[model samples]
Target: MAMLNPMPYEFLGVRHKPNLNNFFGFIYAKVTVPSSVKVPVLPWKDPETEDTIYPRGFFTGHYFSEELKAVEKLGYKVECYIGYEFSQQSLFNEYVNHFYEAKSKAKERWNFEFLTKEEAANKMFYTYAHEVVELNENHLILVSDTTPSRELLEAQDTDSVFVQNPLPQDIVGSGLGQFKDELK
Candidate 1:
């Protein structure tokens, strides 16, 4: 396929500082997708351990960018944020904790199914991405590979669809929590 714009995905800046709530208006207008989609899985049984392997379906990064644009066009200034190494501490600790919990649940719910390390990791990453996306349809958080938060500001790569974490702390600020609260 022909390449689109320099960065087909764009986020509208809501305010000086990133806030989850800031994207609400944009999300209402842009983020629209089915609650559930059929995620692909590979059926495999390890001869050595007789474990069933399950893999999640793949999604494209452009899909996320499009979603964000939809919201931005509706009138929300958002920007993609990425979390990298921090001098203070590991930003991903909280996200890692959640991933473990979610992975455990997935394994149990799938009847003790097994997935390759890569498969498991990808599934967890996508799960978190879905959660973040669900939280704010307008605000787009592109989780790139490790670098620095500042470096992500100039990033223009969309070779992959999975958004890695720990995402920029600001991406899930009060806005996301507020959305969760409203849902509750």
Candidate 2:
């Protein structure tokens, strides 16, 4: 129930770009600037143009999404910002608070229903993740208070490429890429 809060899953499909979708009706009401989160910037400027290549802002006037700023082998340089508008604050606060609440509740569920985090983690690494994992900077979305976040992507010794996350990586789906063979 809480996972589907703010907006329903199907409803979120509006902004999915036909590949990935999300409910975008929760548009930010205020137009003020955002400044809570800090994003990393490039250390050097464009040699030929004599200008910075990236602007390093997160408020794209749409929903929650980030452009991969840079990659350091296994980690990503990501951008994060908090807007000041009433609508902006409302949405941001809701997302954060709701997520925290969900995590707490889910952890309780895990201990009550299944096993402890240590047991699950140490006992063959059996997946006890309640739902789709959303690795935050230091916590798993609705998993545990002490569940640590990864600092870099651990590629599975294969050539498959995937986006980086400050938290951890949990890709949703691929559209055309999923059906590339069928397209061919």
Candidate 3:
């Protein structure tokens, strides 16, 4: 949940600062600002002529979606600001607190019921995630000695590996993608 927070501009598609070169984040919108209208000096405004340069191009790094909505009401075509809205601080804080409480109180371990050896092997082969358990940033415990190998699949189709948490019980979570220990 912390990683999914939009603070990391590149990862969550929400840039903290304005960027005009590329629409890497969801902050920028492609609009057509008219020359007839009187507006403030924006980033895309022409320095000498004081006119809108990119009439039908992206203008980025300045205004929020609410301000852009006002522009849309002025007969301008604005795209990519409808569904996205910046979350209120209190709402975001409540969401974070809920997840924190859930994680802190969770006492169950990850149950790999109905997981086949082949599926486990494939996940390991692609993501290098051992038994789908992320231990820490730099260290992860490999669940099986012979997983991701053809020998495990050929042995039994129903066969699967079990993961035992070697770390302290206080460091475990009951949900998927939760930390197995201190996230450092």
Best by lDDT: 3
Write down the TM-score of every candidate: 0.17, 0.19, 0.24
How do the residues 1-184 of candidate 2 rate in per-residue lDDT, one tens digit apiece? 2232333223322221221112223222112222432334323354679765433433223223211212222143222232111111233445656655665677578753343565445344324433566577654444444322223333322223222433222323222112111111
Residue-wise lDDT of candidate 1 within 31-126, one digit each (tens)? Answer: 222323232222334567967653233221111333355544544343434211111224455665575567678767976654667657756865
Query: Which window of 10 residues has the lowest lDDT sum in candidate 2?
Result: 175-184
Compose the digit string of candidate 3's lDDT tens values, residues 1-184.
3433333122333444333233332355556666544433234665678776534444543445545555767655555542322332333556666765565455234332333477567556646643555476434225343354333232322322323434456545544435333222
Ranked by lDDT, the better of candidates 2 and 3 is 3
Scored by CA lDDT, what does every candidate get? 0.37, 0.32, 0.45
Instruction: Using TM-score, rank the candidates from best to worst.
Output: 3, 2, 1
In model 3, pairs of residues that clash are: 18-61
Candidate of highest TM-score: 3
Off by over 4 Å in 1: 1-86, 112-184
What is the C-alpha local distance difference test score of candidate 1?
0.37
Candidate 3, residue 29: Cα displacement in angstroms equals 1.2
